[model samples]
Target: MQTLPVMHDADTEPLDDAVTRRVQARVGTVLRAKWRIDRVLGIGGMAAVYEGTHRNGKRGAIKMLHLELSVDPEARARFLREGYVANNVGHPGAVSVLDDDVAEDGSVFVVMELLEGKTVDALAEQRPTGRLGITEALRLADQLLDTLAAAHDKGIVHRDLKPENLFLTKDGALKVLDFGLARMREMQSNAKMTKTGNAMGTPAFMPPEQALGEWNRVDARSDLWAVGASLFTLMTGRLVHDAPTLNQLLLKAMTQAPAPIRTVLPGLPAEVAEVVDKSLAFDMNARFQDARGMQAGVRKAIAWLDKHGEPQNLVPVASLGTTSPGAVDSQMVTLKRDPTAPMAAPARPSRLAMIALSLGTLVLGGVVAFFVFGGSSGETPEPGPVASSSAGSARVGAPAPSATPSVAPIAPIEPARVAIEDAGAPPPVPSVTASAVKKGPSVKSGADFGEWGK
Candidate 1:
């Protein structure tokens, strides 16, 4: 009964309020979770990405299927599988998948390493100024080739290797992302077509087989064409081909030859340009066998550049068939020299000098230079006195002196190696799923991308 003077219930109301608040606060207890989806970052056709954090507070990006597609079982399956594939195909240049799960609403979500980068599409939009430097473009091409090579070796073909798919991370790493349509060659082709009524892939970069919707026939060469097209854009900041419709696009892919690299990026190394020409060949057989081959060529060109000075004068190799015999002006002006021959004497004044003056006003600068060093040595030749004469006063009919050594018969520069054959009527429109057309220098087409397979 002596319970601290029986405190009134109303007085204890404040304590009761504190107790209530504490209990309610416990309801907000933080639990250990892999990642907490923060807010939406971007929304795409198939998924929406959110900025997220792990339980330990590590930052990441989480992709969730768009509500519209999340309900579709097939779409969800493909979404989940794509996440798994992204996780497994862990290349430094490929986006990495960290975690994945199915939400209560049957929506699929994937957590990936948060990256700071811009897509190649963005880069293309803001193309670098001046002619596309071969070294820079080749460097990017080499990285892409590495990424594609790995995918191909794993029996995976990136059906969509467009500029948008390429990304440059904050650390200057190039990554290939969104492999949603990448197909494993070992697996059967997917029966589903894209929304465009043809197969997946951007039309501008699609190869002949891809343009025709010949998904089953796609191989590493298809990727080669894409890489070539990509290189063309990187070098020229323009698409190698473009079409208003799917049919026209396919027709061009079948018949058109990419414009010469020099046509856009003038002064590109002949060797490097030739490599690009080979990669962009309309015929799959005419293209480099794979991305690796293209990469090897790029590396070789890089090595050549590193060894020699800047490639101001790349002797056009015979491999680039697209170039005509007179295609390069520099090739016409030969830098006559012999690897094993001895040096020759300098040239003397010619007939023009004999008709004008007995002795030319030996450049005052050259005479000064001669005397500066001439007076220092016993074997030093004497600096002839500068002599001047009136117009046509002397040596009017004297023959010109030939002090320079006789030149050797020089070898003619060879034509480009790959001799392009005018593309020749669209390769006769090979029987295939897609049809493309060459409009001007760009390729175009009108086949329904979604229905091409059907």
Candidate 2:
């Protein structure tokens, strides 16, 4: 755990200097006797992944906890828990966590097998319609379910499941990545955004339960819903639960049945439709309960297609097609990311400042109101002189026409405030210290960190 120097925004900085420093320092300490870090591969919520080579020249990926998250005990524990869970599961489709430990600064780090190729999310974007064909989709779904099956049996649930979390190897093997260690940014971001509005799976892929925030109640059946949505997108090149408003989206999810698979992809066999419909059933009880059960339907679909002489396996066709200018190409269609994506980043202090400012402004106004009312209290001021009507005396110009009446003021209600949780205060800046190479603890061999955290 290397500590990072907190630099100001104006500091002309290397985009990843702090992260690089931490990784280099940790590798020096944990694998100093064995490996040297080369470069950062990517950064996520809790970890920065690096490509490294052992002293013996063996290459691997080294993952270290993000400094911000590592300092928090709850976060650190979860980070290690993800690694521990990954270490227990053994499956070809699952990436293996090789080793793990805490750095001197208390950052959690895990080493894993380095993999090549893009994530499923990336592949979906590269394709013409953001989808794979029926055959390819089935195979991928089968692989995903198989991984989920092993985890489900052990009581592990992939609370977060999405394209970005699933990695595809260069060899065309589908391997589940970030099994339980997806960044907190991704997790919190997903939770806040997966409301009653957008479909929970994705704008297009979200299932009903997820859209309704029932994700916690989700079982293996919830994943089946996602699989069904994925397959539908693959075959039809259209989203089934799409609506401009969240309300309409939920309505479609709960009531509207997906169009049969063959309806969109002409020549698709009836068997494929049956399998998809069964899985897409609004009632989970009607859907396959486990991955093995779902696999049976997929196998049947594949066998039928093979026997019918339909394309037994569809190759991923690339060309996100375009028709009208600036119009999203249906084939190359992808949900565009917001310019300022609303991820839950740590900016606790700033939020606190805003709250304090609002409170101070309200208190100041209240003090002013109290003094004004106090002066006007007690005896009411004598009524102004009134004019005599009958007599020309014009006695007292009628109560100088009661100074134009003022509108009644609304009573102010105090706003209920949110108590901000303090992200621990920053630590003292330190002098430059040369990193020492130290070996990390050895993990037990043949210990399977089962899937989903089981």
Candidate 3:
């Protein structure tokens, strides 16, 4: 498995020449008459792993120590040793190495069985709490212990054990990976970073003896300590020990006790928490002395959890990749309309109905006008008493016309005499002068002059 890059400040240092050479291993380059490199998966300081296919069309991982590192006696030895150790491990829980060779370019490469599942760390990131459920975590831990026991039987000590080195296969089998740090014996003085204290394992998960840089003290028991640390992370979703710097980490692992699983997670089964806590004991003698012993404890924990019904809180969303935005329980949201949502469109009026309605409104307005002021009456009805303060009070003469006009008011008429005419003909009015004018009987309101004549 690939390690996380220790990213440095860009301004502080230039990109290493090894990084450029890593990509130089061209894709589709047939190697060893069988394997063809398809692409580079990742590159470390001394090597890179590529995706490749064999003559049988079986795909696998190809790890190649860079030419620059191949020339170095120590790097060359370590890279080759990893392949040998992993090959000899001969356990289904460990990745199997298929072949190894020195390329024409003078770089050494080893092909391993391709694993198609996420790293433990990747699975943890997919989980909301960075862990698996109690039952599953215990099951995985049991698998890891079995692998470690097998490796220990072969006299292999895996110095580096962390979430990144653990893989969950597509079939849900746990696989231990990256034997690069594994060894039958301690590293020679030449590999030390400092003459005094240079640890080989990841700081967060390293055991006390390993953290102290006492390579001789790291053996099967030390690996078991690492297993405990792994269990702590898998169960509690946190590192067994934490610090900001390497020195702080070493100081804590060497001096302070690891926080109990129960302390981080109170509801966790006490039996399970106890087993993980013992594994992380600062004193090597206080921890499980062998892989078998640790494996027994893990089995017991699993049994306890099964009997008690494991905590449901740690079950992660089933995921093959990173969780997407707003996704939960492995379900993706659709932006399309919901089939269950209500539709509320209004009913539209028909064209014929609208036309009929408009015409009916016009006919009704005409009828209203006929009743109000369209009598064709020549006689004037006396006007209603006007309120002096009203804004619409009419002047004595005429009212101004509006869009729908009221009929005009009539002017007061002076009395006049009419000359008599024959029946069936309308009466002719006498021309009135001041001397011939005569008073007629007062007419009641709204009476037509023709009616008065009748």
Best by TM-score: 3
TM-score of every model?
0.58, 0.56, 0.63
Clashes of each: 44, 19, 0
- Model 1 segments beyond 4 Å from truth? 1-33, 127-132, 189-197, 242-247, 307-454
What is the per-residue lDDT of model 3 for residues 1-454, given as tens digits with 9 covering 90 to 100? 2222222211225337556544444577888688988765544344556678899998877877667667766567766777777777788887788888998788888888776666665566567666767777778888988998899898888777766577776688877777766776444444432123344455566777766666667778888877877776766666665554434555566567876667666677778888888888878898898888988998998888778888765432232222221121111000112234444444555666667556655654555455446676855556655434222444344443234333222333432111122234321111110100011111100100000000
**For model 2, what is the C-alpha lDDT against the true structure?**
0.52
- How far in Å is the alpha carbon of 419 misplaced in model 2? 18
After the best TM-score superposition of candidate 1, give how far the Cα of residue 256 lies from its true spot, in angstroms.
2.7
Compared with the true structure, the alpha-carbon lDDT of candidate 3 equals: 0.60
Top lDDT hit: 3
> For model 3, what is the alpha-carbon lDDT of residue 200?
47
Output the TM-score of candidate 3.
Answer: 0.63
Tens-digit per-residue lDDT, 1-454, candidate 2:
3232322111223336666556555544435356566654444333556666767776777777677777766556655666656655556776777767665566667777777655554556557766666677778878888887776666555544555456666688777755442222234434322222222233244455654445345567777776776677655555555455434444565456665555555556778877887887777788888888998899888877667766544332223221111121111001112324344443334555556556654654454344434467566546555455421222253222222232222344432111121135221111111111111212111111111110
lDDT of each: 0.53, 0.52, 0.60
